[model samples]
Target: MFIIELTYKVPATEIDAAMAGHVAFLEKYYHSGHFLASGRKEPRDGGLIFARATSKGEIEKIISQDPFSINGLASYRIIEFKATKKIKAFDDFAGDEI
Candidate 1:
């Protein structure tokens, strides 16, 4: 399993449109069993998403469809890593416990 952290630099003009699609994406991923948790950062700096996927490619596909990427509302950085272990709260999430 892998964890993907996405940070966006949103432009002022596209904020509402971007957020609408962003929330829609979150709901889609959650129902599809890919998204674990997602939300905007405090002070609205950007957003954070925790997802479980088999490969970086899979995660990339997900991000590529985001409103931030689609409408050019923001940009993102993806960090890929193998999860060695999980403690307490994270471990309690049933889908990707590795």
Candidate 2:
């Protein structure tokens, strides 16, 4: 799994301006089964996304499509992790096979 964190690089106005496109980008990935979950941070300074990809390069390619990235409105911190365990309710995410 990957945790893609997005921190604002430009002003809030710029981020706001791209919110709709960003959301659409996210929805596209979600429908494709690449994203598991995503939302804004608690402090609203940025956002976090849980995603499944074959490799970091795949994740990078995916990130490149984000509106925030295309408009240079945000910076990304991509974290790759092994999904070794999860709640029974989330058994699909409990292995490294993803």
Candidate 3:
């Protein structure tokens, strides 16, 4: 699992302008099962995403497709982790170990 944090690099207006494309990018990943959950951060400075992937490189490739990334509107911080415990609802997405 990975925690993908997006921090705005440009102004909010710039991020807003790319919202539609950004959403489309998110939808694509979500539909493909790479993304589990995502939403804006409090104070609206950036966003957060929970995703599943085999490697950080895979996540980086996915991130490269984001409009925010394409337009250089945001910076990404990808944190990889091993899930020791999770709800039953997340079983499928949580990988085999936990």
Candidate 4:
């Protein structure tokens, strides 16, 4: 399994557009079992998404196609890491083994 930390640089104008498509994209991934959870940062800064993917490249591709990216509402920084450990709530889904 992989953990991706995405930092979005929110731009004012595209907020609504980004949000409109965000839900749709999230639903698509969630039903497909890729997205685990997601939310915006405090102060409504950026957002984060925890996903399970086959490869780092796949994650990048997924993010690149997100509404934020497509509409240029936000820029993103992606950090890909191996899941070495996890706390109770997510323990069942954590690991490099998956």
Better of 1 and 2 by TM-score: 2
TM-score for each predicted model, relative to the true structure: 0.74, 0.89, 0.93, 0.75
Q: Model 3 — TM-score against the truth?
A: 0.93
* Candidate with the larger TM-score of 3 and 4: 3
Query: Which 10-residue window of candidate 4 scores lowest in summed lDDT?
Result: 89-98
Report the lDDT tens digits of candidate 4 across residue range 1-98. Answer: 54544455655455765687878887888887778888777767677788877687788888877887786667666666665566776756553433
Q: Which tens-of-lDDT digit does each residue in 24-88 have in candidate 2? A: 99999888878889999978789999988889999999999998999888899999886565677
* Residue pairs in collision within model 2: none
TM-score order, best first, reads 3, 2, 4, 1
Local distance difference test values of all predictions, in order: 0.70, 0.86, 0.91, 0.70
Model number with the top TM-score: 3
Model 1 Cα shift for residue 97 (angstroms) = 11
**C-alpha RMSD (angstroms) for model 4:** 2.7
* Cα lDDT over the full model 1: 0.70
lDDT winner, 1 or 2: 2
